[model samples]
Target: MLRHFAHPKRLTLVAVPLAVLVAVAVTPQVRGQQGAGAFESSDEVRAAIARAERASKRADRRAQSLERAAGQAEQEAEKIASQSAALAARIQETEAEIAVGKGQLQLIARQQRALDARLGERREPLIRLTGALQNFSRRPLVLSVFRPGSIRESMYLRAVLETTIPQVRGRTAALRAEIDKSRALRAEAEGVLRKLAEEEDRLSLRRTQLAAIETRKRLAARRRGGEADRQEERALAYAEQARDLDGLVDRIDAAGALRDELAELPGPILRPTRPSQARASGTTTRIPPSTSRTVRSPSGLRLPVDGRTLRGFGSVDSKGARSEGLLIRAGAGAQVVTPAPGRVAFSGPFRGYDRIVIIEHPNGWTSLITGLARSDVNVGDTLAEGAPLGVAPPDGGAIGFELRLGGRSANPLDHLSR
Candidate 1:
């Protein structure tokens, strides 16, 4: 009787430590995933892959759409810049989505591996239980009489076996169900991985195409290397003269402030006259000067692009780095426009900000737009309210904007109309 019970008792002791070990091992990972994002189900993984795939497909469509739009663009620079920027952005966005899809696939693979191990751990106990049940079944109750135990003890053993058989069956059924689920999960995970691979391939193709375009552009830019070198030397001289970005911006803002202040002053005006009025007046009858309306307020300005605001001023990302502006996730190939009239202070790439456009508005306010693939406006250009400044790549990703008052960054929400 002791021998018959020994295996199960040993299994119980083993299971306790095994379960504890598993808990100890899994706890950190579970907490890590929780901190990363909510755990994803198989369906969720598939959905993420689908979303990424869709984004790639959209990027393809966007590239073609931008090409067609560029053909109709007003200026050659605008056309080439528009097409290049949009293509580059679309490629970047698709690459990011593909990366996310791959991450999901990896997560699913880990879950599948863990589940397989769990099923494996249950196998030995299940085998022993099944063997014991089969042995008890083979040796009928009549054989207990031949065994070396009291009749009462035999009866108790029989009763205990009868109760335990049902419990074992129930547990076996549950384990089997779980095993089936794990298998299904693994199958689904495999499918997700395959889908992600296909997406990665598609993104790779887009990247290749982007590379070809950039290669051509680089060749063109190299043709201007001589002039570019002189310009670079001048810029370097200025940078060395200014010392830092803040000082450079301050110097630039100082010049812009002078222009803005002079613009605020009334200039000498000479009204035109018709010949009939000139004859009647002996020389000319001056036309009435149109009264200029004051634009003193920074209210009622519209958003630069139509999209959801992902992050606001002071919001931090996964790296805990706070934003200095509003991050908007806009439509693929969407046009980014000026929120208000301003003079383009700088329109070129800045480190980490991508293609950017900075416009100095009146009232000491300057609007900085970033994350564009191409800048439409150039420095010293006057952009009217809602004037197109740049273009987003197809498969629209993040576009950031900062509202600076006197060179100090401020929350754009506070200034933009609701």
Candidate 2:
């Protein structure tokens, strides 16, 4: 099972990386939700930002409209104030006109009373004149016709009686017309006052409408204010997330730098046979200690580290072959060793090698040392066989080990002791 996971075949290699990324992305969400407010996905956060922006735009438009409305209302109110003032002035004028009409009516009443008293005092004289005139003339005082003292006297008296009767009738008609005119003027003044009252009522209704409009605008503003506050809160949360992401990126960058330095160091070398050790006679050895060890060649290679074969070298994929570098199942934090004496080629984190080192040999061979618990070497570092690459695990575990020639992979077993 361990070998199945560690083998760097097409399926294993591709699947494992995807798995790691997914795991990393998912686990954090679960943990965060338990403590923090619901962890928002990137999509969710982005959507919230968009929503806030949209709402802000809408609020801006609404605020502008409200402001315009308020301005218009103010202008209308001012106009109404002017109209109200005009109406008030008109009412005052009507009242003044009504006072004048009352004065005229009072004057007419006084004149009527004076005329009645004068007529009453002259009643006896009028009756006597009427009686005398009735006998001789059709009008109330035909004195010339009644006297007939002389032709000239009779002509003069007849003229006087005719002119006096016509004059008196004209005076009475003129007084009645004046009284009627005064009453009509008083009625017209009352009608003007009634019209002014109606106009005041209309203005009052308009003021009420203006008040309603103001109230509606205020309510809309408050609703928008609450929405704005929520948007701000959402924005703040997103900003905080952005800040956290920046810090994480920085840490990842630091980790990457450390990896690069480690990649350049030489790794451990594997000798096919110990110089003093000899095999027993007549025993078949699975492997002779003379095979090529280099990844490209048949000899000259080294073991990356001292550990059991956690996984063997070969393509294990059932699908098409996809080759990847090896995975050493070393204990976490185990020191990875150099394979042979060589110049450090690379010391960095590759997509497959979390912390890795590559060394270039004098011969066209290269070694990949990965699964490092921690790295002790840096780029451009020189190293030899059995050098202290780093500390190893107390309980041994496999180290991710690979060898390449020129740039192609070679079997690790070819380079080890039989």
TM per candidate comes to: 0.50, 0.27
Best by lDDT: 1
Task: Evaluate all candidate structures by whole-model CA lDDT and list the values in order.
Answer: 0.60, 0.43
Compared with the true structure, model 1 gives a TM-score of: 0.50
> For residues 192-218, what per-residue lDDT tens digits would candidate 1 score against the true structure?
567667856865775566556546654
Query: Which residue segments of model 2 deviate by more than 4 Å?
Result: 1-300, 317-326, 391-398
RMSD of each: 10.1, 47.8
Candidate 2, 107-169: lDDT as tens digits: 333444444454445444444554554454333233444655744654565556555655545
- Candidate 2 matches the true fold with a TM-score of 0.27
Minimum summed lDDT over a 10-residue window in model 2 is located at 27-36
